[model samples]
Target: MSISFRVSNSSKFQVSEFILMGFPGIHRWQHWLSLPFALLYLLAIGANILILITICQDSTLQKPMYHFLGILSVVDMGLATTIMPRILAIFWFDAKVITLPECFAQIYAIHCFLGMESGIFLCMAFDRYVAICHPLRYPSVVTSALILKAILLMVLRNGLFVIPVPVLAAQRNYCSKNEIEHCLCSNLGVTSLACDDRRPNSICQLVLAWLGMGSDLSLIILSYTLILCSVFRLNSAEAATKALSTCSSHLILILFFYTVVVVVSVTHLAETQTTLIPVLLNVLHNIIPPALNPMVYALRTKELRAGFRKVLRLGLKNK
Candidate 1:
């Protein structure tokens, strides 16, 4: 893919496509690895779809929280779909060639969805904070308009900031290697192959990551802290328990998602380019949360489970 940009006009070398090595050290085990990953991808897609359908069908769930949950399902599906198919192709069929444009698109979608997921988490945190802290004002404060605006902001924040990551990478002079050792088109992995200095790409990615996901996580922590304070001050033990229970699923999702994110971030920062640990962590980060999120919500939230059951019953009756 020859990008005829002003800066790279004099560059003699250009890579048309990239060869993904797909776990360089584990070539023998890739077939076995594909089985579990494929299963996880299917579960992620299926569960999120089921959640979306239930939320849309159940009138009682037409509240602000459920609306956010529905948006989350869509994001989860996008997140999983962004990289899993290519990964499966690499593992199953040894189909690892990705054109430059396709790789750039994958990079953009992955980071955008990740940033949006962070935003959704923050929005869900705010929802819980208001519901628990100001029950009286919840109806007024967390309105449909508010949800729409939050989603719009979420999309813009990630969509715009993430563009630079892929753009910076794509603008680089790939005069050397055109092979990536990772399963997906990770920014760092792709940029490392460029003949030019990757400092700009690195700096851009680091700054945007902290500015987007870092801020969202910090605010989520603040919201939860305030919610905890309010819960403890409650007069009745049962009420406190109920408030905590309501946040249990969201908390679990937060814990798992951020934990993997932190590990991956640390590995990237440590510049552990020689090991497969970071690659594996990135795969887990992309796959596990989407698969687990809906299950957590369905099992923890009585309303969602009931909604699912009702949807199932209605479907059966119609048959």
Candidate 2:
């Protein structure tokens, strides 16, 4: 199969070992462009980490809902660390070369974190559902034991299901093509390098993608439906509006995430589309939402806004 190139290299265009077209091949302007991304990555990590700390230390945040929020922060940090450090390395140094094993490792992280994030969203949805639907029982329903079980289940579900895809992709024999046309080592770019039939791996990705994302989406939808039905029963329009406003934020975030998720899913199934398109889509999926996460919650939640004020005051006094 032939491919296109943006680089000026001639002989090595098709048969290159693996030219990772990360940073969109902007060799010169990349250094400058990457500065903003680097700052954003740092900001995302720091914001999430701080939020996690505040959630843990603050007595008001001791509830299971906040437990999920803290967990979400940790996972956000994990996911960002998994990819962005390598991304930074790529920008600072010229070490875009990822060995076969390293490539597999990256894919494993991408899969695992993707699954975990989905699980966290599922947990958050369930949390919202309980709080809205059965406000009286929200505390008891999301008990410590049950939360433990839910986390365990999410871990097992994600780990067991997505592991095989990378393993399968790793086992495939790459004839000569090794160029990953993206910033990070992804399942598709790796699978595309294989010389032999990759239909199985492709199918595995589709299935897992459907199961992981689709399942999360279905659960979220179900929860929201229940929530919508229950919320309308409340007598206070102000209360209903407040609750709807919160749901609206999550809905917007889910919509943003699904835009990339569905687009990439369709791109994979299309088989004729440019891999670059998906690579960019995947990058947006992995980065933009995360960068906005803290901002979203902060702008919406009164406590976080207050916490930010307190923290800023403390920092100023310290200075």
Candidate 3:
């Protein structure tokens, strides 16, 4: 990677771009390591696109739940796209240099999409909650207008909340080395390189993360708890089984999503000496969930499975 030197205001040289070391200790094997990451990234993009297409073309999927699923696919694609390409470049071609603007954009985008995903998960949980817990009110409670409002809220909320993170990072003085330790331009990774104290950035990020994804996760737990209570209260065993089955796929998706998130958060907070594990886990957290979401839904949800089959048959017949 070539470095273009620029002068900072303090007669010190500012770093115009940053070098992203793919993995700290495993740089020699990056070419070999890129294979699985590449596959997972492609799977994430392809699967989410497939889901989006199926959801858009199928009229029967116009319900609130499907609306949120479509939004989730979009968010998943955004999250995967935000960091995976640069990671692939760093791994495959030694294209590790990222400009200041590019770094900031990645930080903003990754955080925005993450916040949106958490919000989408919460919305889906609420959808299931209303569907099972308040069957009679489900139609009125969850509507197209409501879904639209929720989408708008998510976009505005996350977009506004994350704008500061990149802005704060951009304002700092970068008189030192410009090499970021991680594969992507994470907020902490980028900001930590600044010459100034990074505590404000860290504290702001910690607070916003809790206010955003943390709160979403907490509400999701509550929603599911209510759902379980409603399911158990059903007088008939078959009805309870049906209700639980409806949420099983969603529960699995949520479990893996939050598990990876929690693990990654803990690792970051712990500030362990071994950074590779957390970095790799973060990459998997972004890529694996998007790839797995469509499969989980298709295999577990009857309607989505039928929708996928119909869409596939239509495409093949057209071909």
Candidate 4:
């Protein structure tokens, strides 16, 4: 079940092992480079987890917006867990081999989380839309039951969309280069090795691009446009300024998140002799967004600023 289907019977595509090209040119300062990545990975997880805890424990943050923010933290953790461990392993250990099952699992986790994150972000945009554009009805519009249902649907959609990808991909023959050019089992990385015509896989990817990311980005854009229009129509300058500040956090988040997604999603055609550029971009695409999100939200949101202060005070008290 876990075997790579190679064309030739003599040499099965090495299922139990995969070759990883770790951070190129890191042999000289591998140890030094690892420290920063280690720190960043730790910070990324810590900050995101902290945000999750604050959102959950604080009664004031139990609203639909923070509820979704907490969910984003969970998704960020999922994304970070899927990538950072493999990335850290490459730096820590000399061995960069992954078993066939493990490799496919990584692919699944990566795609599923990314897809799910998109849906969640779209939900968040709509959440902001209701909160801002229709403030009077925001509570009724984004009820706890409705938020849960939206979250479940998003999770279910991403899960269903990406679930078959790795499975179908793993079933194909991989007699070609077993050495993956990236740190992890990237979707295109695995599919590139398959001897079978990857039209179906390509189609699936296109469907996801249009349906998952495309749809989400569109809705987010529309929400923001409406939000901006509403803000401008306000008579008070202070009110308009305050609205933009809130919108800016989401806009910044969207910029970082979607740029990488768009980059990697389209870079499939850019593969040539060396996958160095594409693979590096792919890893960056995953890591940078999750890493940037907490910082952006914390810096941009006054409420989040207050929460950080409160969290710090509580921590000091506990200490």
Which lDDT values do the candidates have, in the order given? 0.91, 0.75, 0.87, 0.77
How many clashes (backbone atoms < 3 Å, residues ≥3 apart in a chain or on different chains) does model 1 have? 1
Cα displacement (Å) at residue 35, model 2: 1.4
Separate clash counts for every candidate: 1, 0, 0, 0
Q: Tens-digit lDDT track for model 1 on 127-182?
A: 99999999999999999999999999999888898999999998888875787889
Q: Provide the lDDT at 289 for model 3.
A: 84
C-alpha root-mean-square deviation, each candidate: 2.7, 5.3, 1.5, 3.1
Q: What is the per-residue lDDT of model 2 for residues 59-171, given as tens digits with 9 covering 90 to 100?
A: 66677766876777777777777787777777778567766677787788878877888888888888889888888997789899988999899888888888888799866
Top candidate when judged by lDDT against the true structure: 1
lDDT of 4 by residue, 1-319 (tens): 1334333465655344677766544544554656766777787798898888777666667778788888888888888888888878887785677877898889888888988888888988898888788989987889989988998898888888887778777767776567675678876777777777866777777776688788889988998999989988999999888777767887888888888776765675765544456666777777777777888888887787788778789989999
Ranking by lDDT: 1, 3, 4, 2
Better of 3 and 4 by TM-score: 3
Worst 10 residues of 4 by lDDT: 1-10
Candidate 2 Cα errors over 4 Å, as ranges: 1-19, 23-28, 271-275, 315-319
The positional error of residue 143 in candidate 4, measured at the CA in angstroms, is: 1.2
